[model samples]
Target: MSEQIEDRNVARAGRLDTATLSDAMDRLGIVGQCRAIKPRDAGFRMAGRAFTILYGPAASPPGTVGDFIDDVPPGHVIVLDNGGRTDATVWGDIMTEIAHRRGIAGTVIDGINRDVHLCLSLGYPVFSRDNWMRTGKDRVQVEATNVPVNIGDVRVAPSDILRGDADGLVSIPRGHEERILAAAEEIEAAENAIRKAVAGGMRLDEARAQYRYHQLQTRAEGAKP
Candidate 1:
């Protein structure tokens, strides 16, 4: 996708919540939900295209954790795949501060991060398995960047859109994001109509029936996304 188009999608994602997007994905038979990747703060939220990093056990006389941050484009999310290791953290206070200052959207780790307080204080969104103080300095090394990586059992490729909210994070495959956004918007509008109907003295069941609530997230076909 062009940079301009990606920017538009990211902005659109910022307006929608994860739950609604998940429902859209469900209707579309798409799988992009990142399991176990909870937000560090319930109030935290993020939306951006991914800049993925793949990690592995360090090598003998391990290479320096590459200075990848400086190259990350502003408004892009830093996606770290650490094999879900919690013993050593790949992110910390310094990283959080830098990311916030650099205009980076957020960070999501399949593993753990450090400096929870800093992230919370900066209001910088971070979705990870957990937080710890132990550094991954010599324990893990970057195996690759901008490559496909497994996050919460979901394969997230570079440039994929990810959104996180109080509930959790979900990756929207780049190839299907536009359609997903359209579907989500449609579902959200129907839900709003349902709410308005309920408030206007309509029976709850009738309101739901009018908007087809039960079938809103149900797909007409078993075709996979």
Candidate 2:
């Protein structure tokens, strides 16, 4: 029975599309929207499940935020939900190194992060609202790991499909990964056909009309004369 549960979890995580993940982010209206770090050198491509970390102001002691970094697993992104505070830094240089060494996919914070140069130099992916040199202990702490966390009005659970690029970051609910991916693939195909039509000397208006780019109007009109 335990094995079956484990298998089910694995199957669920694997439902996401490796290629269409980014595209889905774009189609779903969640892409390239993260605030870029100064001297922007932080970005990476990773495929795996998500491991979330929750945070709060009174969550931990002073000078000990690194302790939370120890709990992350390999092939998982350390998503930190710091209640959207842009004042303190929840991530830093040492923490970045440790996370990378542990095979962590990346780090996403709903707050500020420090050590921008170090993280970028290490080729570790980090997504946050802003960057700063302030330490986390002064204003933030890791309250829990692999738990639900609120990020920008969204509650993210562990093992969700997280795909982000220069555009922005997005969390795809685990159960909806397969369906969303299938939808994104179909959307891509439809757009590609439209592009080909335009490239074949068809006027922009003609292409748009041929593809019914305004499908809404057709639906509404079908109910009329």
Candidate 3:
């Protein structure tokens, strides 16, 4: 995508919540809803392109955990895939402090993270299966960076836009971002209209029917959403 288009879409996505985007993905027959992964703090929010990192078991004499932080661009989320290991944490307070200072959008881990207080205090979003204090240093090593990785059963590639909120996180594939954004905007508009209609005392059923709410996310078989 061109820089201008990416900027516009990212800005638009920043204004939306994960719920609406999930609905859009459903309508478009795309699977972007991340399951199980949740925000460290309920108030935390983030939207940014992904900078993926993959992790795997360490070998004898174990490799270094990583020195990849400095390479991430601002406004890009750090995605760490540890194959859902909860016994060790791939992130901690130090990473959070640096990421926050560097303007990194947030960090999403397929495993767990330590130092919850620092992340919460810094107001930096960190989404993962859960949090714990055990370090992943020697247990896992950086397998690769900027490669495709899985999160909550969904495959996320580099540059995929991730939006996290109180509910959870949802990813927008770079290939289908434009269509998903447009669909999500449409869904949001209709929902907003429903709220206004109800506020004006219109019957709930009538408002839904008038706005085609029932079919908004119903995928049309074999057609693009």
RMSD of each predicted structure: 1.1, 6.1, 1.2
lDDT of each: 0.93, 0.63, 0.93
Q: Which ranges of candidate 2 are over 4 A from the true structure?
A: 1-47, 59-63, 215-225
Ranking by TM-score: 3, 1, 2
Q: Which 10 successive residues of model 3 have the least lDDT summed?
A: 216-225
List where candidate 1 sits over 4 angstroms from the true fold: none
lDDT of 2 at 71: 68
Cα lDDT of model 3 by residue, 78-144, tens digit: 9999999999998998889999999999999999999999988889999999998998878999989
* Model 2 lDDT on a 0 to 1 scale: 0.63
lDDT of 1: 0.93
Candidate 1 lDDT over residue span 90-111, tens digit each:
9998889999999999999999
Q: Which of candidates 1 and 2 reaches a greater TM-score?
A: 1
**lDDT score at residue 218, model 1, on the 0-100 scale:** 94
Q: How many backbone clashes does candidate 3 have?
A: 0
